[model samples]
Each structure stands twice: as structure tokens, then as C-alpha cells.
Target: MSTSVADYLLDRLRAWRVDQVFGYPGDGINGIIGAFGRADNDPKFIQSRHEEMSAFEAVGYAKFSGNLGVCLATSGPGAIHLLNGLYDAKLDHVPILAIVGQTDRSAMGGSYQQEVDLHSLFKDVASDYVHTVTVPEQLPNVLDRAIRTALSRKAPTALIIPNDVQELKYSPPGHEFKMVPSSLDLTWPQVIPDDTAVRRAAEVLNAGEKVAILVGQGARSASVEVQQVAERLGAGVAKALLGKDVLSDEIPYVTGSIGLLGTRPTYEMMRDCDTLLTVGSSFPYSQFLPALDQARAVQIDNDASLIGMRYPYEVNVVGDAAPTLQALLPLLDERADKSWQADIESKVARWWETMDSEAHVDADPINPMRLFSEASPRLPDDAIVIADSGSAADWYARLLRFRGHMRGSLSGTLASMGPGVPYAIGAKFAASDRPVIVFEGDGAMQMNGLAELITIARYWQEWTDPRLVIAVLHNNDLNQVTWELRAMGGSPTFIESQALPNVDYAGFARSLGLEALTVIVPDELGLAWDKALSADRPTVLDVHCDPNVPPIPPHATFEQASNAAQALLRGDAEAWGVVKQGVKTKVREIWPGSSS
Candidate 1:
């Protein structure tokens, strides 16, 4: 007898370290589910109320483990529903493998129920695909290759395992299964910029009195390199929020995140700095960048296109942050500029101590900056933060400083909504015992199907509570970024449309059997939130807030923009005119202050 294709595929996934599979069941592939039952496997099968939630759960697992997240569905509509959630993983570069059940070979012409062309449906979304027919030999190769491709590119892949194929029986000694290692030995590229370019960057650093280093997400993997580079020049450093753990914040050069939620002194120093060295970030915020009239930027990154895309660069070098910095560090000389670094550190500490200026506000609702600051301390030191997109993410970046060991990852440029729910979902499944939090906007919470949260509830039951997620809901009835857009004079309707309405998220969450509460006051936040955080199950703290609030900009940039604000110190209408004209007159590049 020949073994079934689905069984072979399952064996391969087991070898790939898939501890669980999330999916919605249907016809045409009940054979695969049956096979899962027969094996009495350790990888638990999670049933999602909707197929969309299955995909969300898979993404959650993938993002947390940095491994292949698996989701399954029967052919036709089941396979199709996987698109939106799969695309979430794709855009974010999360490794996911969607095993979609297809119809029997005999039903090729759509004779069977729920039959559809799997290839065409999943096109444009799945980075790779596996077509499994036979169980003995061919299927395993497809499984290995598909799994490898997903992990290699840090992207998702799809596999179409037919129903009839899984039911087919094979004889003894037909084939043996193979386990693929999840990691590869990757190295810096052989090509390095000539010593002359390195020397030029070194010279610019040596000559500049008030130079600063701006770290991006790419530096996360190269923390040592960033530290060495910052040390060689005694440079002050500020990070894009996504690069939270690039280096320990204890370093004297560290000044915190740059942008709106960034430090005033860091922004001012960037403007005053003779040289700005940007590494590995395509930070979208243009307004927070240093002035072109003053600072000359030197940039290095693995991606050549990002160089000089946002800001004008006097020097551009293409290489990984660490390798390039390693070459440049040897040519650098230390500066006697401890004063600037020391001054910035003092200001950063001041902001850290009283980020809300509570001595002034007395009460502020849902202070994202302050929440992250206070809550981050309670989290496990080795905990990994998997974040969603939107204002929730922006706040985490602005406030949360990672201990050297904690790693944080989020949807980068794709910046898709609803990822927070799925990400929190994934991280919980990946590390059941770790302190996992999902601070997402209300809009994102709904997009994350209720079933995913229920699944988290189920896991927490087994893993001993809070094994799923500490979900912090920002309920402002508006997309937080809409406030920023309006601040720039965007259409009111567009801004209004983003605010979610009419959903009783707390009620819905409580209905799903997760611990849930809604907070109306600031003092109630910490205690009510801890109820969920301290619970033995998943919890959501739905907190209402004022949507009209905008992010606090970096103090130093505020001073310059204040100086720029001097261009129209006249009055209200006058101030609007100055901001409008200034924004329009400048080019649309990330660092819009560039004259070029």
C-alpha cells in the first residue's frame, strides 16, 4: 500500500518543529484532519471559527518563533480565505506555510465539491508553493523545499496537498522522511567598499564636533557593530523605534528614539551635528531628520536603494551595518566630545523619568509613552515583543527600551493594520510561558477574528494563564495616525472614516471567555490592566482615549520647527499658512528639509 500525501506532508512539518496547526475544517480534505487524529500527534490542532482567524494564528506563531507558521484549509473557499491573513505574513516577512487541502486528481474539471485552482488563487501572495501528489517520495521533497524557501527569504509559502492523495495507502519501506534545519549560515558579502570611502567617513567623524549616529532596524542584528562605531567617535546615538534593542540604552551615547516621541536634545543635536551617520533604516518620518544646511550625512546599509532616498548623503556606502562598521572602526579616532553625549543623556533621563509631565497634566488617558515605560519593566527579561502596525507600534518604539537580551519585531514598511492581534496571537503560541503583550488599536482588534483570541484562551488554559497575550486596546474611535494626517491638514472625512465605531470589544472579548475590562480613568489603568497581566488566561483591557491628541515631537526638532515656526509667529491662520507653505515648498523625501 502507498502512504497518503497528507500524512507525508504532516511528517515533514513535524520535523520542521511545527508544534501546532491552526485552521478551519471542511470537505475535500477531511482526510488530512483524519490523519492528524490517527497519529495522536503532539502538535495540537486548533479549530478556528473562521478561516481568517486560522491564518492569523499561524502568523502569530511564525512571528514569535521566527519559524514556519502553519495554517490549513480545504479547497475552494477554504483555500481562498487564507489570502488576506497570508498576505499579512507575506508583507511582514513572517515565515508561514499554508497547507491548503485540494480536490482529488479525478476531480480536475471541478466535478468534486469545493474544487478550485490552488495555484492561480494563491498567486501574487505566496512567495513559494508545493504541489504534493505521491506520499512515498515526491511529497517530502516538495515539503522540504517549500519550508526552506519560506525560512530562507523570511517570507511565507503555500502547499496544496490533495484530499485523495492523503487517503491513498502505500506499501512498506517505500520512503524515509527527512528533517530540514531551520537556520542557515549566512555571512557578510565578500565585497566591501574601498578603504578610501571608509577613510572619508572616518575623517568626517574625526573632524565633526557634534556628530550623532542614527541607528535603524538593520542594526538590531549588529548590536556590537553599532556600539563599536558609536564608541570609535564617542558619538551620541538615537534609534528609530523599531530598532529598540539595537544596543543597550545604558550606553552613554544612547539618546532614545528619533521622530515625534523622540528626544528634543537628540533632534537638536542632529540639527547641530557636523556629521550624521545613518545606518540601516528607511525611517518614513521626514520632519524629524537633521537639517541639510548644517549636517552632512554618511549612510551605510545592505539595501543600496534606501541610501540617500530619505535624506541627502555626502557619503553612501553599501554593506551590512556590522561588516561596514567593522571596516570603518579601525580607521576612526576618538573625539574629545564627551560634553554633547553627556548633555543628551541627562535630557533623555529627564524624559524617561516624567514622560507624561504628570507634574503638569495630573491625569492623561492612555499615555502610550508612559505605559510602555512602566509596563516594560514588569516584562520578562528574555521576552520577545511581536508588535502590530499603527500608532500602538509608534508608541512602543518611542517609549519601550529593551534590556539587551529582549528582542522586538514588528511589521516594518508593510505597516498593515490588524497585525497586532495576530502578532500577539502568534507570539503567545510561540512562547507560551513568556510575558507576551498585544497593545493594538481597536480597529486592529476587530480585524483580528474573535476566534484567534479564543484559541489564545484555550492555550492559556493549558499553559497556565497569561500564556497567551496581555492585550492593551487603544479605543479612540479613530485611527491614531488620522490625527497626524489632520495635523497636516488632511481631509476630515478621510480622518473620520478610520475611527472604528459600534463594536463592544470588551463585551465581545468577555463573550469569548477571555478576561476583559474597560478603563475610563488613568489611575484605574495600572490596576485594571494588571488583572489581565496577572491572570492565568488571555485578557484585554479596553481603554477609551481622546483621539484629538497628537504625538509629542522631539524637543530639539521642536525648537528648530519653532525657529521655523518663527517664520509665522504672527497668529492662528498665519501659523497654518506657514506650515502648509513650508510642507509644500519642501520636496516629499523623508527628510524634507533638504534643499535638493
Candidate 2:
């Protein structure tokens, strides 16, 4: 029997143990999708509503499930659409393989409708890009290596297949594929560095008057290791938005997140710390980092590129955080530094004292902080929250405070839009015990194929388990970024400057048989939330929000500020030049030990 190149692609994915594949298909991918059906014992293929979301869904699935997420897209505009989400997978080091279908090989020069140089386009985003030219030489070892790079480095990799390859007929007796294995030899230190650095760190930590440890995404994979370091140091642990899973709030040292959406106490403790140690956290929020001169700081991470890349470090200890801490814990002089830890704890106490007061509630529409607070009380402590780009980040930053019981994934450095629902799907598949909560903006949701809700429904069909999940849409009908751009001295009227209207998200959800609902205020929130947690079905909650909500990313545009000062003669505000100086300040504070 003869097989097609499309069949071989499906075989490779199966060999890699991939169970689900995501993407939307146009004519360019028709042959491939057709070839990969149940008749051939193909791995199940999932059709997402948007190309970008498919990319995100694939990455999130790979990240949580510890398996490859395979996504497909047609070339040209379709391939281009994959970049934003693909960038997120690369930045976060999520293992995903995007198989993009190109225009027929012969149409490469004519700029055919679906024609694009997918190889060159994906070079920066993927670990490697390979296209099947002839069928016989389909290197399985090479295919295996692509997956390895993505898994090992926490990056996205690509496999491009042109239409010709997909349609080509191949005879039996294909070359047998030999698997490639992980090649890293651990002959060197399994840990990060020598005992000298750890001992010095322990000494400073033991002597500190106030100590706070800021955790970041780098610690996500080593949550246990990070927890050990915090316990031994007797340091209070506060996380960046991405570090929510490291230490649960139930744990003594695990406090809230620090930043615009963070608890003020975490910020206060960081500022008050006599010594602050950052563990695997390149937390990129400068607005919350402590004064560099106030504390002795040390950083631990596996990637050297992250070291001293943000702020100056009093001590740069480059090694594995888990082993390094285990070695340091025993070497330390066991003298307790209770008062310092106590003092920072006191500051947190004060901040919490005011948190519940009228300040936490707001009537102003689209206040992300207030929205998160209200949503927080309604959400399951264990639910995973996937936040999208734009003002949605602001809401998650302000409102999505993680109790130790909860965990989720959102944008950090390469904060792009449209990953919310798709990421939520991935997170759900990764850990099925808890329902996934997707907090998305109206502008963002339109970009992802909400039809992905169908994928969830299909997988959990027959109401077999009764899926209890919903994508909460914060629908504000404007790019809203126009406000930021105007503040940034850029015109607000650029392309896609405004969000489209007449979007009936609930209507769309209903069509898919998803239990869709919408919330208009704090009171209506509980019903939807409670229902999601109680049932075994997927849901979509589309809530209308005020378009005036501002971004949290220090977006006071210098140009706007200058004009405002000239017109209002309001020299009361600081100069834009001063704010510019703070970019490096923000960079260092969040990326301690990194160069600006």
C-alpha cells in the first residue's frame, strides 16, 4: 500500500506520543486534513476557530501534559497568524510543533493566495523549521530532534509541509525511522555552583532584618525546589504574576503577587527587605520591585542570559536552585532571623487591613482590580486562569490574586493577545482535576476560533463527566489600546484601532451547545461561577465592560504628558523624561541581575 506525505506527518506525531492536534484549515490544508482521518488510525485532529489560538492551544497542552501539541495552519496569512501565539510558546518555553500547510511548491514565486515562506517566517519563533521535499528521506531522527529541542529548551518548533508533499503518493516499504534521544551529559555539576556562594547567601539571609523572596516563571517547573529555598532561608515568598503556583498562600511564607494587580503588602515587604533573593523569577514588573540599595540581593536561575540582565545583583549565584539550596541549608549557622521576617509580615498585615475596605469595591466599569476581586471570590481556588493580552493583562495583574490552591498561565515578557481560551483548553487538558477559567477581552476573543469550545465539548461529549468550565469574556468595544498609543505619542486611528460590534458571544456559545452566560455586575457573577464549578460541561460567560479602562503598564505617554503640561500648565506631574529613566529602573527591579 502507498501512503502520502500527510500520512507520514501523522505517523511522526503518533511516534512522538501526541494525542491531539489543533488548527483551522483552508483549501491549502484540505488534502492534509482529509488524509488524517479515523480510517488511517491518525491521532485525533482538533479544529480550532482561529490559527493563532490553535498555536496557543498546542503550546499550553504540551506544557501541562508533558507531550507534544501538534497544530496545523495553511500558509500565507494563515502562517502569519500563528506568529503571535507561537512567540508566546517560545518565550514561555512551551513545547509545541506547528505544521503549516504551504501553497503548492510550484506556486512559491507567484505569491499565491496561501503562498508564504513559512520556513523563513518561523525561523525566529521555532527551534527548527523543516519541509518534506521528497517522501523517502523523511528523517525521523531529525523529526525527533525537533521535538527534543522544543521540550529541552521550552521552545516551539515547526514542521512545514507544502501542498505538493501532502498530495504526493508514496509506495510501501518506507524507510524505518530511528528515534533520537536527549543528548545532555551531566558529567559537570548537577547543581549550579560552589558552596561559597550558597554559604554567603545563607549568611546574609540569616542576618537580614526583613527578607522577601520574589519568585518568577523560571521557578514554575521547579516549584518544589523553590519552596525548599524559601523555607530554609526563612524568607517570605512573593511571586510575579507568572509565579502563582510556586508556594500556595496557605503556606506561611507564600504571600500574594506583587505588581500593579498585586497585593500592596508584597510590594511593601520587598521594599522593606534587608535581603531579597529572586528564585527563577525574572519578574518583569518594575513598579513592584524593591529599592536595590536597600537590600542585599542574590539570584538563582539555569539560564545565564537571564543573569544580571535586569538589575544589578549584590551576589549572582548561577546554579540549580534546588540542589544549591539543599547544600546551603545544612551549611548555614542556624541562628534565627525572626524579627526581619516578622517585620515584613507586619507590613503585609497592614496592607491587608485596608484591602477589604471600600477600596476593593468599585462601581466604575472595567476596573480590572475590582473585577478580579469580585471574580476571585466566585472562582474555585483550584481553577486555572488564562489571561489574554491588552487590558486583560491589567485585570489579571490587578485582580487575579492566587490563593495557594489555584494556578494558571498568562502573558509575561512576550505578552501577546488571543491565547486566553486556547491556553485555557491546554491547561484544562494538562490537569483535568480542575476546571479551566479563561478571562478574555472581547477584542482578543474574536481572534481565536471560539469554535475550540467545540473541541472541548467533543472530547467531553455526552455530558459524560459534565464539564464545568467557562470563558469569561470582558467585552469592551474598542481597541482600547488606542488610548495607550495616544498616550505613547502614536496615533489612535491605526489599523484595527477599534473593536468590532454586534458580537453575540453568548449566541455563538449556544450554537455550539456550550452553556454560555453573561454577567453585568458583581451580583450576577456567583451564579455563572458556581454553575461552572458544579457541572461537568464547558461554559462561556460574556460580560460587557466599560471601554475606558486604562492599561496598567505605566502607559502615561511622555508625549501626551508633555502636551498636557503645556496646555494645563500642570507642572505638578513629573516629567516624561523622568518616567523614561524608570524603564531601566523597572527592568532592573523585575529582572534583578540583568543589564538594561
Candidate 3:
């Protein structure tokens, strides 16, 4: 009746306050599965439909909860399936620990079933730290270090346990030679940049009449400080996609988002700024930033490696966003002239008006922008929004407004698909009392979202506040790639590659006992959101949207415009619709008050 390695591992996770593990079972981890049964699910084993989804759910949990996310998977194919999601966590800099089962030790070097080399497989994705536990004594130290490394580095880590080792009697690392003992407690230090660096950054900010501030997810805890700094410098703040909710969109001086899926005001601010102060963001698109000689820039980030990257900076301050900003604020001088602030506010106001006009534009069926626009005002103050990569991200970025305690995220760095529904599921587990919403394209839904709905149905009733809504843009096309081909490649829509098979997303939701609605027109979007948000359980809104609606960039280059024109001229499958929708959507920016 002694504790097995599997039992001790679960106990250790519980000791670390890990209450749930998202995973799918396989024979490779039969010993661990038996331990879960014996432990009576104290640290609940939340089974995902697939191993990839499990990793994604853990990432989502980590992101929203601001804690360590742990995922489990069987070895071989199960381990391979987890790479994409693990890469998502790694690239996004989320803290996740992946515990994967390996083949039995007796079969080592024998090429047995499910005996792939896991260490090599995970070395790249979990390069921060990846280790295998060969003996019962090695379990505690390896598991503890994996958790500590994932949290400290803010990256994915891995621990591989062989089937034979998992069933062996548990034993602790003693005071014997060659034994490495570990501790559970870890206190994060408050990192603040030296006063000299802060002063130099302040001087750069003080000299410029036109200051531009960019914030990323690293600024999440420093929203107040970011605002104070922006106000002091008379700057307009722009958000990286990962930092969308760092500051409220309701702030007059805050530009919506930066880069391709960004607003015109943000693009113009970066283009015209004389001083650039980047806080906790590594927005990769250098083209969207100020020209090399145009501005003096300063960047503050905790990670020294990412500080001077993306853009050259006059001063790089290595520290946490909140404390660094706090240090810099005292040295900053408040600008008496409010002209730059006034101009930014004016542009921000006009941009919202343009978004409204674009949302109301007529289309073949539903305008995709209308779904997010209508949902924005109706979202709960504490709701968490998750968007999948693709066309849905376009609307989510430009149209939706996040304020109050509301939070939102996507696969920002990796830009992967099929994590929308799984992320939502994980968010619910992270904050069971808060409502969760997901914006997904039909292509993503078909890829993995539909199956995750069954996972939703299996656990929705357990939630204290059961309000999870999934809005699927049923455009019947791989819309994002379709637009990319026209804009980037100067190629007409390749029907075979762009078109998607029609699926009854709403029907599938209803079949799983969840409330479902299908909206074929724009007017129904508002009511659909209202119902879904108030539903006692998870709901799906399958809105048929126009695939030809172009996701035009805020500042589309002449080359991009020319390429798109060439695509239509070459006889795109929906050339006429594309032309009509593109013109209608773009005109709203020129004449915000015009109805036609």
C-alpha cells in the first residue's frame, strides 16, 4: 500500500497548488491513469479530446489565471501531437509544465511501441528546461525544477516519466552523495532599472513634443503606471496584440492596436512620433514603427534578450514594467501644452466612428465586423474574450472594446489556429465565476473547435457561472489566407484551397445539449449575442458572413493595394463581391458620416 511514483507526482502537484491537469489518456501512461483513480481525483484530471487541445487548454489556463499551467500526455504520438500547442505557449511566453509519459525502461533502444525519443522531441519547444526522471528519487527534484523553470523563465518546460519508473515505489532524494534536493517556495524579486537608465529614458521622453507609447502583455500589471506615463508625456498609447487589454479602449489617448491588425490612428501615431517609449512589448513588425532616424526610442522590459530587439533603442531599461514606469514617472515633466494629446484624442474618436460605419456596411449576408461590434457593448464587465487566428482575429482586434476587469488573448506570437474553443474551456477553469466568449472562424471550428464543444458539454454544469459563448463566422472559406493570397501574392482566389466545407456548427452544439442559434443577417447579431451572453450554459452563434469582405490593413501599402487589384482583374472567384465590399468598407474611413 506504499505510494507509487505516479501517486507521489500527483501529490507533489497538489502541494504546488495545481488543482487540475488537462490531458488525454493512453496505454503509455496506464500507471499514471491508475494513480489518478486511486487518488480520487483530488487534483482533478481534466481529460481533453486530444493531446494538442490539452496543451492549448493548459496555456489558456496559465495566461488567464496568471499561474503555472500543467498538461499531461502519453508518449510517442501523444507527445508529438502536443508540439503545436507547446510551441504556442513557448512563443507566447506562457508558463506551462508538460508532463509526458515515456515508454517502459525495459524496452529502451529496442524501438518498441510508443518508444520515440521524447527528450529530442521536446528539446526545442521546451528548451528552457526539459528532463527525464529515471528513478523514484529523481522525480521530486525534476518535477520541482520543471515547475520553477517554467514560472521563472515564463516558458514551457517538460518532464518525461517512463511507464516502469512511474509504477515503482516512491523514495525521496536523501542526504546521499550525488543527490539534488529541491525546495517548493520561490519568491519573485521586484526588478527595477538603475536610476541613471531611468533618467536617460526620461530625458528622451522630455525632449520630444510628439511622444508615442507602445504597451504589451508585460504591461498588464502596470495599467495605472502606463496611463500616468502616457499622460505625463502627452503621448498616445498603442497596444500590441498581446496587450490589447492592458489599458482600456475607453481611454481617449489609447490607440486600439498596432501592426497589420491595428487601427489607422495607431499607424499614424507611430509614423509621426518623434519619441518612442516601448513598455513590455516586442511587437515584431518594424515597418509599423517610426523610421530609424525619425525618433529617439527607449524600451523597458524584464527580459534583457528582447529589450533592444524589434527596434533600436536609445536606452534599454531592464526591469518589470510597473516598477520601471514608476521610477521613470518621478523624473518626467508634465507637458503644459495639450496639443499632442488633443490630436490623439481627435483621431481616436474618428477611428471609432469609422469602425461603426464599417460595421454597418451592407454585404452579401452578414458583415463580419457587425458581430464583434454588436458584441462589444454587450460583453460582461468581467468576461474573458478569446479569439482564434484568421479572419476572426481581424474583427476582434479592430472592433471589440475591452474595459473594466475584462481580459482577452489569442495565439499572439505563434498565430496558430484551433485553440479558440480549447482556450475558452481553460479560461472557464481558470475563472469559473466569470463568463467566457470565443470568436472563431468556420475553418478553425472544423479543425478542432467542434470536438471541444463536447468537452464543454461534459463540464459546463460544474461551473458556478455558466456563460460560455462561441461565435463562429460561417463564411465557408479560409478567409484570412484567401485575403493574404490576393494582397501578398497578387494571386486570384484559388477555389480549391480557399473554399471550406459547410458545417452546421449550431446544429452540432444543439446535438451536444447546448443552446445554439444561427444568424443569417446582420440585424440578428445583437440579439444573438444578448441571448448567448445570458444563457445558463454554453451557447454557439453560427453567423453566416460574407467571405469576400476584405480585411484591409489600416495603412495598406501601394504594393498591397496593387496586388489585390491585380488579383481581382485576374478573375478571382468572387471578384465582383470583393470589389463591392472593399470599396464600401474603405469609404467609411474617408467619410465617417456618409451612409452611402
How badly does each model clash, as a count of residue pairs? 16, 27, 0
| Per-residue lDDT of candidate 3, residues 251-303 (tens digit) | 99999899999999999999999999999998999989999889999999999
Global fold similarity of model 1 (TM-score): 0.77
- TM-score, each model? 0.77, 0.80, 0.99
Give the per-residue lDDT digits (tens) of candidate 2, residues 469-515: 54444544443464454454434334344656557777788787778
102-143 per-residue lDDT for model 1 (tens digits): 887877776667878777887778846545454444566566
Ranking by TM-score: 3, 2, 1
Predicted model with the maximum lDDT: 3
Off by over 4 Å in 3: none
Least accurate stretch of 10 residues (summed lDDT) in model 2?
179-188
What TM-score would you give candidate 2 relative to the actual structure? 0.80
* Alpha carbon deviation, residue 86, candidate 1 (Å): 3.3
Instruction: Please give the lDDT score at residue 433 for candidate 2.
Output: 69
